[model samples]
Target: MSRRPPDGEAPVVTAIVVAFDSAHALPDCLDALRGEGIATIVVDNASTDDSAALSERRGARVIRNGRNEGYGRANNTGVRAADTEFVLIVNPDVIVQKGAVAALVDAAQRYPDAGFFAPQIVEPSGRVFFQPRSLLAKHLTNPGGKLVLPEGEACAPFFSGACFLMRRSFFLDLGGFDEKIFLFYEDDDLCRRIADTGAALIYVPQARVGHGRGRSSGPKPGLVFKSRWHQAWSRAYVSRKYGLPDPAPSMFAVNALKTLAAGLSFRRSLIERYGGSAAGALAFLRGRSALRQEGLS
Candidate 1:
């Protein structure tokens, strides 16, 4: 059932945190959201740990999946379950700063035509993480350039999937994230579609969230390989889908050669990195679906 506030009350914004074995990070993430008095929903993607139970204890509505649905699909589930007009999608490894939610809400109202609003994501070391370039432009035009921080409220090329606020109706209209993506490049795909509709993707620097980047999945080598593999596959898929120059052929050749060298040197991590990309590229070239990749998960 949808959780909505009374008609006369202020518009409610729900925070959706998609968790997968993220018990280590959920407490802080959920606690910050609860502290801000924002309703939160935690979608557990078949986590082997107590992520679901922990979220419930933290006063969050929990949705438990029987099997691991990919990140985008799990987020789609959370967004659908939310009854609010606006929803904040955040990673489990993120701690929402005080007033951040309100800042995003304000930005939403200020930019009525925007389909998405993103908070400034800060790393543990206090470095700001903001990518102002579009994916195509970054790769094709400026391969190496200094990252520039936007001032105040500004239009963004694309917001990071790690943390962002999106209108529920606009999200639903775009059909949410593409489920076929499974993991990586889902944000790029969504942003591309939003651009098609000519809706702005606003970046609100006043809002801030501390992100423990790459900590949600932990440091399991198997998980690392899985992430790398899906990243390559998803990148190839999105590039092809949007008529961008396909990188699968070149990716496959380079990674395949590197994989052979790494295997000869007995470098396990390098083997995983190079071999995963090679396999992913080959899979895409052969018309294999990312979701159907066996033994990776």
Candidate 2:
């Protein structure tokens, strides 16, 4: 039986934090959720640290998995356990400002048609990261600075899943993230799937969340490599799924060019990494390699 939130109670908002060795970020994340009076769910993916215990101590309902499940799978696990009407899937590294959660929930409510809603995303330094927007304009604009779209402009190219909230029913109906995409493109895939069902993803400028950039990736080179590798592989998967213009052949060609350029540029490290990745990409393009899989979470 499904657990139902009491009528007239603040719509139960389940904030799902998927943690994998994220001891440092967990407390801040849990505190933000509890501060907002949002029910918190922490899904620990086999953290070597005392992450699970810490989350429980902080009053978050904890779910422990013996093995590391990649991002998508871990999130799905949390979503499945939630009993809320609205679900806010957040990264452990994000800090919710006062009223951010309420604003997101209100935006979703007001925009009834929107499948997902998120606020302006920013770095800890108060600089705006690219909030969700159409692909063309997003790429055309410079990376930093506030991007205010003109009235009637396309608001969303895709939903920003990193710190967005969605209706629980709509989220589950879409079957959650594509498990095949272990990392990067899973968010894009989810947005596309929502669009396929004719639901829009809205950006609520009123809401705001501060993200610590690369909190998981920056200090760890191996994890960074895995992230980039998964990105390349998931790009192929997205291209295949959404019928985006064929990027494999071009990506392979570009990687080959980069490998040569790196070698000529006297960047030995770049050459080593790009050369191997390019070789794998070429093999993929030629049907000589298997579809890349996500590493254990």
Name the best candidate (by TM-score): 1
Instruction: Compose the digit string of candidate 2's lDDT tens values, residues 45-103.
Output: 88888789999999989999987777888899899999888899988888787788888
lDDT of 2 at 41: 89
Worst 10 residues of 2 by lDDT: 132-141
- Model 2 spans > 4 angstroms off: 1-11, 131-154, 256-297
lDDT of 1 by residue, 154-197 (tens): 87667788999989989998999998988889998898888788
Model 1 worst lDDT window (10 residues): 136-145
Q: Model 2: which residue pairs collide?
A: 133-157, 134-157
Residue-level lDDT for 220 in candidate 2: 42
Using lDDT, give the best candidate's number: 1
List clash counts for every candidate, in order: 0, 2
Report how far residue 244 has shifted in candidate 2, in Å. 2.1
